[model samples]
Target: MDASASPAAAAPDPASTPGPGPVPPPAPVSRLRRLAVPVGAMAAAVAAFGYVAAVDPNEPGHYPVCPMLRFTGLLCPGCGGLRSAHAFAHGDLATALGSNALAVVGYVVLAVVWLLWTVRASRGRPLRIGVAPVYWWGIGAVLLVFSVVRNLPFGSALAP
Candidate 1:
């Protein structure tokens, strides 16, 4: 019990204290689990495309006309999307573009995004597509312009 040698001085150094070793890495994901969501999504899309390809949307009564076009006699953004999908599924690029160029572009965009999503999921890193509100608003504005332009005689080429 010397004045200079306190009880605290007898304690062991924290750095030297024994504890659990370094943590192990996370378990690898199962192959089936890795492919499940991407595969399922692709299968569903393929099924829908297949249906559209077989059904012939150009035939009257096969698919309902867009309500906006029906009520207002004005082409909406999605007026010819079904016909575009139908033509795209049949490998008719020109017909697809003629039906709705924007919808054809949308198909290409969806394919690219789905490819990236599948690749990331297979690698055990899921993709999170988070677009800002401003970008969404810009997309809406573009769609509005497209709709308005397609309805005008000057932009009749875009009409379905």
Candidate 2:
């Protein structure tokens, strides 16, 4: 009747217990598999740039007019983006900046982000582009200001 002699006090044998076995490590990723997404994305981007570089957007009909500009005479943030890309692709940085400074900044930002993504993908790591909602709103606000300024007489230099 001693508490120390109770059957319930004995520990169960781990070998006798049914449980999940040790987990296997994840399979190694092949180099091609690891780099596939980034390389494909870069290829698509290069193709698009090549097309834009060859076909001029300044010719008016080559690209569609911005509806905002066409309808209301108001320039939207992306009004001259194609022209900017064309200028950028041809290495005319000044014309690119004149066409759309924001678009030039966008190209730089895309390049930086793509570089980071490519590097992370090559290393077999997930690309993390977690921008906060506030930052996105801030970017929108900046674009709006840029659009408004470029349309005004004082900011004519920003107009395409």
Candidate 3:
């Protein structure tokens, strides 16, 4: 401590210290912008289903045969999916279910999933599908059973 060293002389100037000034608030996001992903997904689905409805899958040569059904004479889980979609698009629920019950169930599941996605997106939140392993196994089991049943003699009604 020197005799001439005063407390004010040792202090640094506050103006020289770097500090962050007032930060501007974040720009507000619009509702439509928040729902962009969901809207795009819905548009894509509508376009695909619209095309499937326009072109008849029941008519041979309109659409390619399922590779699994072509190679093996067995009905896969997605054997009559296009026919199901065609019937569904035409508002014929019975025919859609008859064409492919599993595909009809899938359509319902997809709709529910899409609704969930849209709702979350509208609320500015991301949709997170965190299915447990058990659920995945259950889905696999359903597909396996559907494929097997549609191919068996007792499951003639399930066949397309």
Candidate 4:
């Protein structure tokens, strides 16, 4: 060492030097931040369902009439969905099915999907949903058939 060199003037430690590998940058958000959107959406949906449950649509004037049915005097597939939800909320399965069988099925599907969504969100995984075009067309076809059937005299029992 030089006579004038002090302890602070020594060669830099190899451990303190930059390494050969590229450094990974810090994440823009923590794990909790990534979960916020999904959690919020789930909460909103639950609140909406709670509101629908609390406001029973079975009472004739509680909810607005379905415009399509009012104008056409024909039952659309969704004609009695609100009532169905009301029935479902009250634990009246028969009334729910009577009001709207499709709505009951939709409720079940929504519940299942929501459960999966919550699980995926908690696990910090991206949600994935892919409804093929054919499936969408099939849904449309089913709705069309339901509308037609509900309006026919033979299917009067299915009418809302």
Candidate 5:
């Protein structure tokens, strides 16, 4: 050590130290407040399904034609989604699948995700979907395949 270096210089300054002040605790979260989002979302979905159930999508001009089906003469992945939802809302699983299996699957998935979200929120924990990039790519690939297959002669059953 250098002789010029002083021990006082190495010492921590008391003036710079933080005081023992009382810090207030965070406000307690209410259960209703935590559950509000999930409940509202569920209500919105139920209302939408109820609307679709009341309206007949199978009837011509009741709903807008699929843009891809109109322009390209090709069945898009979501071509029969509305019809599927209508059938599903009416408790006709067979017709729902016949209209659009993917949409039916989507409805089921959404319900499951919503249920999970509700459960987590009730416990004051935030739910996260950390799906890998590969999973997203796989989903895209499935949609592309469904679109292509539903338009083919062999896949006429999948058509809307």
Candidate 6:
């Protein structure tokens, strides 16, 4: 011991000593914080779907008709998507496809992705959005083709 040291500091005191004792674990997250994002998304999706179902696209003047169809006498890729969703919600698969085959395909894809997202979230994993550039390009190309073909007289069936 050094002669200059304080008497209190000189003696090793077990009561005053600080060491790494057992550390308490972090508190678990609150339920609201954990579920907020997912619940909000689902609510929004459901609300949008419900709104589309309630508003009839087929009934002229209820919803604005597609201007592209009026001007060029063509069916745009998104022309009948609202009607398709309405039909789909009502379990009219054929009518849904007739309204917009692309939209039906999109709905199926959305359902699958949503299912996967929900499962992953429940398992405490982050949401995944993995799409290659090629896949994106392919989707774009398909939409372009649908738009062009539906406009042509030859693809009258594809027209809304």
Error of 6 at 26 (Å): 6.5
- The most accurate candidate by TM-score is 5
- lDDT (tens digit, per residue) of candidate 4 on 1-160: 6844877657777778888866789766666877788778778877877888998776777788888878988888998888888788779899889999999999899878877876787676777999999999999999999989988999887876
Tens digit of per-residue lDDT, candidate 2, span 1-160: 8876877667777878889977899999997898998899999999999999999998868888888998999889997889999999999999999899899999999999999998998888999889999999999999989988988999988898
Candidate 6 displacement at residue 159 in angstroms: 1.7
Q: Please report, as a residue range, the 10-residue window in candidate 4 with the lowest summed lDDT.
A: 1-10
Q: Which ten residues in a row have the lowest lDDT in candidate 1?
A: 3-12
Candidate 1's TM-score: 0.82
Q: What lDDT score is found at residue 83 in candidate 4?
A: 81
Comparing 1 with 4 on TM-score, the higher-scoring candidate is 1
Candidate lDDT values, in order = 0.91, 0.91, 0.91, 0.83, 0.93, 0.83
Q: How good is model 5 by TM-score? A: 0.87
True lDDT of residue 120, candidate 2: 93
Shift in Å, residue 158, candidate 2? 0.7
Clashing pairs in 3: none
How far residue 30's Cα lies from its native spot in candidate 4, in Å, is 5.1
Q: Per-residue CA lDDT of candidate 1, range 87-131, in tens?
A: 999999999999999999998998999999988888888799999
Tens digit per residue, CA lDDT, model 6, 1-160: 6775988667988866898877899897665666667877878988988887888777878788779878977678999888889898888999999888999999888878877776677666778799999999999999999999877888877766
Candidate 6: regions farther than 4 A off: 1-27, 30-32
What TM-score would you give candidate 4 relative to the actual structure? 0.76
Off by over 4 Å in 4: 1-34
Who is ahead in lDDT, 1 or 3? Answer: 1
TM-score on alpha carbons, each prediction: 0.82, 0.84, 0.83, 0.76, 0.87, 0.75
Which residue window of length 10 is worst by lDDT in model 2? 4-13
